[model samples]
Target: MKSLSLIVLLSMVFSCNTSAQKKDDQLQNKTAFKVTKTDAEWKAQLTDDQYQVLRKAATERPFSSPLNNNHSKGTYVCAACKTPLYKSEHKFDSGTGWPSFDRVIEGNVAFSTDTTIGYMRNEEHCATCGGHLGHVFDDGPRATTGKRHCINGDALEFVPAKS
Candidate 1:
């Protein structure tokens, strides 16, 4: 009788563990997060490198961003707003010294006229918060979009999507 009771108790614990794991999985699958911040609030929340790349419109050195070699399944988010900006599947090796994505998360990033470097370039920014991300160019392989979203690695934080 004691052996039978022990088996029943173990079964109950296994069932509960499985249920908890399911709930955890559901929560982890969620990618949506609140994305609103005041200027000062954002400045305080981010570091100097994050602020420069995400706020003041700066770029990191070529192949200098850690994300340049990041080949993980995830979503890249704006360091300022936490808005989903790119998918890991869209990220690729561009040999441009920055993390390059073939595309961005929908309705998250926007393009603008950037003349800061004394040349006309497509500047990228967080669409929801107006935070600078980097630039985009037409030089990319034909396998994906002919556009490369040249992003400052400091401006982004990658969150792996649940498979």
Candidate 2:
């Protein structure tokens, strides 16, 4: 009876450890390695609207973005990581609810294939911080390479260069 009880206790301990490890693995796989801060820290740093759009992948209304009317020459950096992702010259009026950029700052962003919406879309994010910016579509105006990167304005912060 003593040996049987010991075996049962050991099995329970092993099972608990396995369950904890599995939970850790699931969390690590869901989030990319570039994010260094905790969830609580991110929530504290970003506004509720900003967090909803940037971290939760929420989309803003069309023409409602503050960056839509921004015509100044500068660079747009990630609000979470400060990684410069777009140049002011590459921005144009897509009339989409979000800010549209024709091109990205060289090596500032990375592409991922997202199929969550039942369609294949090119998802864009900060290369340095893994923050979700938005999607890039092939349909765009003639001024660019025929690519429209429809990004969330809340995901970025514009810094105008000194003239």
Best by TM-score: 2
Model 2: per-residue Cα lDDT over 1-163, one tens digit each:
9999999999998777565455334333436446667778879999887787767777777777789889999999999988889999899988776889988987888776666789988878777766778999999877658999999989999999988
Locate the minimum summed-lDDT window of 10 residues in model 2: 23-32
lDDT, each prediction: 0.78, 0.81
All predictions: root-mean-square deviation over Cα?
18.0, 8.9
lDDT score, residue 93, model 1? 87
Deviation in Å, model 1, residue 59 alpha carbon: 1.4
The residue pairs in collision within model 1 are 62-97, 63-97
Number of the top lDDT candidate: 2
How do all models score by TM-score? 0.74, 0.77
Number of colliding residue pairs in each model? 2, 1
Stretches off by above 4 angstroms in model 2 are 1-35
Model 1, TM vs. native: 0.74
Instruction: Please provide, for model 1 over 37-96, each residue's C-alpha lDDT reduced to its tens digit, 9 standing for 90 to 100.
Output: 566886799998887777667777778778889998999998777789999888888888
Instruction: Tell me the deviation in Å of residue 48 in model 1.
Output: 0.9
The 10 consecutive residues of candidate 1 with the worst lDDT sum are 24-33
